[model samples]
Target: MIVRVIESDNELQQAFNVRMEVFVLEQKVSEDIEIDELEEEATHFIGYEDMTPIAASRLRFVEEYGKLERICILKDYRGKSHGKELIEAMEATISAKGYKKAKLNAQTHAEGFYQKLGYTTVSGEFLDAGIPHVTMIKEL
Candidate 1:
């Protein structure tokens, strides 16, 4: 897997396509909700397999930490450790930007995965886009 920060509009579009497939199409998330205004302020990342995008995520600076958002791996790419790699790469990217901490609102079902990556749940269960989620944080 080749994961890198998306530096161009074309690359951003590729990442968006992957998120659309995983979130909008497969998970039935509303298209209106999946694409947000943060795209302009956040730094995006894309994971590619043999030159084709297979995963996507974004990081945005909050008050004192970087917020990880829109993490998605396509259905066909689900079983591997690509999602973990994506988060790791995102961490490296944000860390390079001088962030000492990272946070995310993880889907409840995926909380264990984030826990395995050293994130601790910091908030009680909540709903985002009608999906159960919990806020998690980790030190970079």
Candidate 2:
């Protein structure tokens, strides 16, 4: 398994497919917002298992708000290290971009994962894409 940032349309397509599988089909999130205006602008990271995309995320610098997002992973790949690898890649991308911190709105059930990766909960639980989530941040 090799994990890295998305650098081509092929990788980007794989990342999009992963998101569609998890968010749209498995989680039933709205397709309208799943691929929104922000996608084209956000930086993307992806993970491949034997050259097949299995996990991914997007990074967007919200200017004054900080670098936020990139929190999607494949269901079948979940208990493995793909999610963590994706986050680490995002952190590296943030650091390279000169961002002091990175943030993400994590699903409530996955709070522990982010926390383990050095993120701290900074917001109360809220519904996002029909699932409970909490905003979290971590220094780069």
Candidate 3:
């Protein structure tokens, strides 16, 4: 998988499409909640296999950390390490931007995956977009 920082409207739309498939369609998250007001303020990323978008995520500087948000991989692409690649790319960008920490509200089912990537759960489970999630943080 090739992960790139989204730099064009077309690339951003591709990212949104992947998110729609994974989050809104498969997970049943509402479109209104999935695509929120923060879109304009976040730096988005899209991962591609050849020319096909497979994964998507976004980063926002919050306080002293880079906040990772809306991370997803298309259903067909799960378990292939594309998600990990996408995350590493985001983390690299966070560090490059001089942030010393990264944080995210990870869906409970995916908490273990984030742990293996060096994130530590810092908060109890909470509901977000009607799904269970916990806040996780990692030092860059």
- For model 2, the stretches where C-alpha displacement exceeds 4 angstroms are 64-70
Candidate 3, position 117, lDDT = 96
| Best model number under lDDT | 3
Residue pairs that clash (backbone atoms under 3 angstroms), model 1: none
Measured over all alpha carbons after superposition, the RMSD of each candidate to the real structure, in angstroms, is 0.8, 1.4, 0.6
Deviation of model 3 at 13, angstroms:
0.6
Model 3 RMSD to the real structure?
Answer: 0.6
Residue clash pairs of candidate 3: none
TM-scores of all candidate predictions against the true structure: 0.97, 0.93, 0.98
Model 1, CA-based lDDT: 0.94
Which regions of candidate 1 fall more than 4 Å away from where they truly are? none
Each model's C-alpha lDDT? Answer: 0.94, 0.83, 0.95
Badly placed stretches (over 4 Å) of model 3 are none
* Ranking of all candidate structures by their TM-score, best first: 3, 1, 2
Error of 1 at 57 (Å): 0.6
State candidate 2's TM-score: 0.93
Cα lDDT of model 1 by residue, 1-140, tens digit = 99999988899999999999999988889999899887889989999999989999999999988999999999888879999999999899879999999999999999999999999999999989889999999998
**By lDDT, is 2 or 3 better?**
3
